[model samples]
Target: MSRLLDMKEFGEAAPFLRKSDLEILAAQTVAFDDKPTKNIVGAWILITDPLCAGKKRAWIPDEKDAYIEVEIREIDGDKVIVETKDGKTYSGLFCVTVNPYKWLPVYTAPVVAAYKGKRRSEAPPHIYSIADNAYNDMLRNRENQSMLITGESGAGKTVNTKRVIQYFAIVAALGEASSKKGGPATKTGGTLEDQIIEANPAMEAFGNAKTLRNDNSSRFPLKQNQSERRRGKRLLPSRQCHSYTREALMIIQWNIRAFNTVKNWPWMKLFFKIKPLLRSAATEKELAALKEEFLKLKEALEKSEAKRKELEEKQVSLIQEKNDLSLQLQAAATEKTCRLYEDQMNESKAKVEELQRQLSDTNTQRARAQAESAELGRKLEERESLVSQLQRTKNSLSQNIEELKKQLDEETKAAMMAEELKKEQDTSAHLERMKKNMEQTIKDLQMRLDEAEQIALKGGKKQIQKLESRVRDLENELESEQKKSNEFQKGVRKYERRIKELTYQTEEDRKNMARLQELIDKLQAKVKTYKRQAEEAEEQANTNLTKYKKIQHELDDAEERADIAESQVNKLRTRTRDPGSKASPKACS
Candidate 1:
C-alpha cells in the first residue's frame, strides 16, 4: 500500500487549501466572525461550512503572540518568493535567496505513488532514490545503511538532510515493533511524545559534543511547520460554538464579491491557465453548484438566525428569572438572619438579668470578707509590738556577754607577759657566762687565720671569677670570627655559581649573534640579487611595451592605407560600370 503526500501541501497549503481559489473564495464570503475583548482590546473570528461550524476559523491577532505562539510566524514569510522558485521550498534554508519560499509541486501524493516500493534503479535520479536505496540496502543486507551528504555553505545540505528525515519518517517508519528471535521487541510501541523524549538524550549528547568549529552539527530544532499550522482548532477559543448568526444577506453579498476576487489570485490564474479549457464547462458547473450551495446556505443561515434570536430572547428571560429567584432567596436569608438576631437578643437580656443577681450576692460576700480581714489586721499589730519588746531584751543580753569576754582576754595577756620577763632574766645570765668562754677561743682562732694559706684561700674566689669572665669574652669573639668565615664561604660559592651562569649566557648570546649575522648576510645577498633581477625585468618590460606601441602604431597606419586603397578600387569599379561619365584626374587620384 502506498500513500503519497505533497511536500508542497505539507509546507505551504492548508488541509483544505490545496485548491486555494475555491476554498479561499468560501473563506472570504462565509462571515466576518468576531469575538471582541478589552484585554488591551483585540478579537478573534470563526468561519466554517455547515457541519464544520466552529471547527474552521482564522486567527485574528490578539496579542504579540496573536493568541498562542511567539512571533516565529515570521520565519518562512521573509523567504517566500525566492524559496518558492524552481519548486523547491525548504532547500532555501541552506541557500541565500531573494524571495521567500514555501511549498512546491514536487513530493505530492501523486508523485509518491511512483516511488513507493520501487528500487533505486527503478526510479529516476532523485532524493527519494537515495533514501530508498539506503532503505533497501538495509533490509537486504541485514545491516545499517547510511546516506552521507556533504557540501559547502548555500549548497542545500541542510535542506537535503531534512528531506532524508521526512523520507525515513514516512517510508521505513519505526512506529511498529518487530519481534526478534521469537521474543517481543524491547520497545513494542511508543507515542510521538515518547519517541521525542527518547531522542532528546541523543540530541543532547551530540549537540554537547559538537565544537565551535562544527556549528552546523549543533542545536538541531527538529521543528515541524506542519504541526504548528495543523494542531490548531481553527484558532477558535476553547469554548467554541458562540452560536451567533451572521446575516445571510451580508454573506451573499460578500460571496458575490469573493467570486470576482478569487479569479485574480495567482493560484486561480495558474489553475485556469494550466487547465485545458480551464475545462471551462466544469467551471460553469462548479459556479452553478456553488450558487446553489450558497442559496441553501443562505436559507439555512436565515432559519438559524431566526431560531438563534428566539433562543436569545429565551436566554434573556431565563437570566431575568434567575435574578428574580436570587433576589427572593436573599430576602428570605435576611428575614432568617433578623429572626435569629432577635432570639439572640432575648437570650442575652435574660443572661444580663441573672448576672445582675449574682453580682449582688458577690457584693454581700465581699463585705463579710472585709470585716474578718480588719479583725485579723488588729491582732497582727499586737503581736508585732510584743516581738519588738523581746528583740530589745536580747540585744541588752548580748552586750553584757561581749564586755565579759574583753575583760578575760586582757587578764590572760598580762599574765603571759610576766612569765616572758622571768625567762629573759635567766637567758641573760647564761649568755654572760658563754661570752667569757668565747673571748679565750678568739685569741687562738686569730693566730690560725694569720697564716698565708688561709689568706690565699679567701682571695682565690675573686681571682677565679675574673678568669671566668675573661674566658667568656674570648669565646664570644671566637664564635663571631667563625660565623664570618662561614658567611664568606657561602658568598664565595654563590659568586662562583653566578659567574658560571653569566659565562654560559654570554656564550649563548655570542652563538645567537653569529647566527643572526650569517642570516643577515644571506638576506642581503638575496636582496641584491632580487634588486638586480627586478631592474632587469623592469628594463625588459619597458622595452617590450615600447616595441608593442610601435607595432600597434604601424598596424594602425597600414589599416588606414588599406581602407583608402579599397575605396579607390570601389570608385574605379563604379566608374567602369558608368562608362558614360567623364573621369577627372583629381577624382582618379
Candidate 2:
C-alpha cells in the first residue's frame, strides 16, 4: 500500500497524473468508506458458486450504464478462460475482473515463471513466456533480434519493458560469470547490463506523463534497436554505449521543453544540472583511453625506425662486396684465355660445318622414308578395300544360304500339304459312294412297297398286315441312313475348312518365296560387284608394295652416309677439348 502511494506521488511530480484526477480518486475512496455497511464478499465465493462460477453474468457498467454479459468458463493451473456477451473469448494465465467496489487485476506469476525459457507451444500463454522466447532466439541466432511491445495508454507497457530489461541484465551477468570459469574477472564499471538497468528510472522520470486513461503513461516513446557487428557477434548495446548518453540528453531536453510552459518543477532543474556532468565524464574517459593508445603506437613507431637503420647498414656492406668481386673477375681475364677462346671458336665452326653436312644427308633419308611410308599407306588402303569387298561377299553368301534354307522349308511344307490333301480326297470319295448306295436302297424299298400294296389287293388281310409291318421296318432303316448321311456332311464341312486354311497358308508361302527370290537376286548382284572390286584392289596393292620396297632401299643408303659424317664430327670435338694433343687444325685437314 505504501509503495502504491509512493508511485501515485511520483506520478504527480512527474506530471503523469493530473491534480484533478487525483482529487476525484481521493473523493471516490472517501465516499466508498462512508457508505452504508454491507456483507463482506470473498472472491472465492464467485469462483466456487454453481450459478456464477464457470458461467456468464450480465452487469450494468458504472460509467455507461449499459449491461454486458461476461462468462468465466474455466480456471486452471495453465490458464483461465473468459467470454463476453458477443461470444468473444480470451484465455491467458492473467485476467482482469471488475466488481461493484473496485477493479481487480489478477496475476498467475508463479505459473508463468514455471514455463520460462520454454517454447510458446510448450509453455502456457503468457507475456513473460514471449519475452523468454525472444531472449532464447537472440542467444541461439547470434544475430540481431527485436521484440515490439505496443499497446494503448495504461496497458502496462512500461512495466513489461522494465521486466524484460531486468531479465536480460540478470541473465547476461550470470552468463558472463559462468564463462569466466575461474579466469580473471572482467571489470564491469560501465557494462551494457549495468547501464541499461540504471537508465530505466531516468527514462520513466522524464518521459512519462499523465493521460486520461493511464496515470503514468509514456509521452515520448521508447525504442529498442537491436543490431549485430559485421565481423563479430557482439550485441549492439555492448558496442554502442556512447550513444546512450545522447539519447539521455534528448530525453532530458524533451522534459525541459514540456515543463517550460509550467512553473517551478524542482526535478526538472535537477535534471538540467546533472546533464552536463554526465556528458563531461563520458568525454573525459574516452580522451584518456585514446591518449593511452596513442602513446603505445608512438613507441612502436620508434622501434621500427631503429630496425630500419640496421637493415640499411647491412645493405651497404652487400653492395661493396659485389663491386670487389666484379673487379677480381676483370683482373682474371688474360691474353692466354682470350687466345684459347678463339681456338675453341674455330673448332666449333669446323664441327658446325660437319653437322650441317650430316643434317643434309638426314634430310634426304627422311624424305625417302616419307615417300616409302606414303607408298605403304597406299598399299594398306588397297588391302583394306579388298578386305571390305571380301566381307561383303561373305555377307551375301550368308544371305543366299538363308534364302535357300527358306525355300527348302517351303518345299517340305508343300509336300506335307499335298499328302494331307490326297488323304482328304480319298475320304471324300468314299463318303460320296456311301451316299449313292443309300439313294439306290431307298428306290428299291419304294418299289417293293408298291408291289406289296398290289399283293394286298389280290391276297387276304394277313398279307396286307405283313406288308405294312415290313414297310415300317424299311422306314426305320431309312432314318438310320439319313443320320449317317448327316454325319458324312459334317465330315465334308471339316475337310472343306482344312482345305481353305491350307490354301491361305500356301498363298503366304508363295509370297515369302517371291520375296526371298528378289533378295537372292540382289545379293548375287552385290557379290559380283564385290568380286570385281576385290580384284582391282589386289592389283593396286601389289603395285604399291613394289614401290615401297625401292624407297626403303634408298633410305638405308642415305642413313649410312649420315652416320659417316657424324663420326668425323665427334673426332673434331675430342681434339678441341684436349689442348695437349699433337693434332692441330691444319694436321686434321
Candidate 3:
C-alpha cells in the first residue's frame, strides 16, 4: 500500500518531476500504517523537491521554522529517518514541510474537472474535489447543504471558501443556462451570477483581515446555508432564506469576554429586553442620510432668509421714496409756484380770447372797408364813363358847329348876290322883310352854341375832380384796415404759442401724477408681501421652538429611563450577592 501511494504521487507529478528525482523518491521506504510518516514523506517528495520547482515555484517555510535544511535522510513503512543540516537525526510525526507553489495547479485541475462533469471518484483525493462532489450530490438530490469552513487564523480558509463559492456559482449558472433553451435569464432584473460573485467581496470587506500567514484572512467563523426549494416540479433556490452571519459574529465579539460567566443566561430573553434600544439607535446609513437632508434644508432656509432680508431692504427703500414723494407733494400744494403758474395760464387764456375778439373785429372792419372801397370803385368807374360820354358829345357838337359856320358863310354870299340882283330889278317890299328875318335868326343860334360849349366843359372838369378825391380817400381807409388785420394775426399767433406751452406743461403734470400714483401702489403691494413673509417666518420659528422643546423632553425622559435601569441593575447585583433575596423572590411569586 505504501509503494502504491508513492507510485501514485510520483505518477501525478511525473510531468514536472525529473526521472532521477523519482528514482531517489522511489528508492525510499514508504510508510502507510504511520499516518504522520506517510503524510510528511509525501509532502516532502512532492512539494519540497528542487527538481519539481519551476520558475514561479519554490519552497516556503512554516511559521515555526528555526533553521533551513534538507532534513529527510531515509524512509520506510514503519519508521523514517531525517537529518537536519546540523546532522541531528529524528523520526516522528513532529515534522515540518515547506509549501510549494508548483503543487496548487496540479491539485486544482482534477477538482475543476470534477465540477465540470467528471465523477468525483475519478478525480484525485483533494479537499476541493471532495467539497465539489458533495455539493454536486446535494444539487442532484435536490437537498440543502451547509458548509462550515474553519481553521487557524492564517490557514487560507477564507480564500478556499471563496474558491468553492466561485466554482459553485459558475457551474450552477452554466447548468441553469443549459436547461433553458433560450439562455441564462435574469428575471429579477439583476444578474444572479454577478450578485453571487459579489457576495464574496462584500463579505470580505467587513469580515476579512490581514494576518502573518495570510493577507486576506477571515477573523470570524462563517456559516453558509444553500438550499433548493421545490415548487411543483421546479427546483430553485429559496428566496426567503436569510443569513445573519455578520450580526452573529458581531454579537459573539461583543460578549466574548463574558461568554463563560453568562454561559447559562437566557439569550432570547435578553435580546427581547434590548430589542427596543437596538431599534432606537440610529444606523450608520440612516444617520448619514439624515445629516445630508439636514444640510440641504439648512441651505434652503438660509437662501429663503437671505431673500427675505433683500425684500426687507427693498421695502425700506420704497418707504423712503414714498415719504419723499409725499413731502414733495405737500410742498407743492403749499408753495406759491403752482398758483403763479395757474395765474399765468389764466392770463394767457384771457389774452388769447381777447386777441380772438380783436381779430374778429378787425375782420368785420376789413369787410366793411372792402365794401366801401368796392362802392367807391364803382362810382369812380361811373364818373370815368360820364367823362367819356361828355367828351364824345363835345366832339359831335364841335363838328356840327363847323358845318353850320360853313353853311352860314355860303348863305351870306348868296344873300349879297341876291341884294345886288334886287337893286337891279328894283326889289319888291316882301323880299326885304324875309331877308332881315333870316339874318336875326342866324345870330341867335350862334350865341346859343357858344353857351352850351362852355357849360359842357365846366361840368365835365368838376365831375373828374370829385371822383379823384373819393378814390384817394378810399385807398387810405383800405391801407389802415389791412394794417389792423395784420396786427391781429400777429397777436393770434403769439396767444396760440402761449396756449400750446400751457397745455404741454399741464400734460407733463398729469403724467407725473400718474407715475407717482403707480409707484405708491407698487410700494403698498410690496409692504403687504413683506408683512406676509415676516408672519410666515415667525410661525416657522415658533414651530421650530416647539420641536426643539419636544426633543429636549424626550432626551430627558430617555436619560431618566437609563438612570432607572442602571439603579435596577445595581440593585439586582446586590440582591444576587445576598442569599436572603432568594426567599424574597419565592414570597413575591
Q: Work out the TM-score per prediction.
A: 0.21, 0.21, 0.21
Give lDDT tens digits, candidate 2, residues 459-528: 7577667768877986887798679668766866775676567567666756766775676566556556
Tens digit per residue, CA lDDT, model 3, 1-589: 1223332432444343224456758766565442332124433532223332223332334435743444444544333444333332453222122234334443343334333544434533444454555556666775544454555665556665656655555454455453355532223223653444334332342232212113332443241122233231232222211234345455666787676667657996687688878865658679989999999999999999999999999999999999999977865653444455445555555555555555565556555655655555565556556556655655565566556556655655665576456544534433454466456545644554455466556676665565577568757856875696577567656656755665565566556556655655665565555556555555555555555555555546555655555555555546445755576798889
Best by lDDT: 2
In candidate 1, what are the lDDT values of residues 427-494, reduced to their tens digit?
56546644654574465345434542465676867655655785697578668756965775676566
- Model 1 clash pairs are 4-109, 6-108, 79-100, 79-101, 80-100, 80-101, 81-100, 82-99, 82-100, 84-101
Model 2 error, position 265 (Å): 90
In model 1, which range of ten residues has the least summed lDDT? 77-86
Against the true structure, candidate 1 has what lDDT? 0.49
The 10 consecutive residues of candidate 3 with the worst lDDT sum are: 232-241
Candidate 2's clash total is: 2
Stretches > 4 Å off in candidate 2: 1-332, 409-419, 438-589
lDDT of each: 0.49, 0.53, 0.51
Task: Point out the higher-scoring one by TM-score: 2 or 3.
Answer: 2
Off by over 4 Å in 3: 1-456, 521-525, 552-589
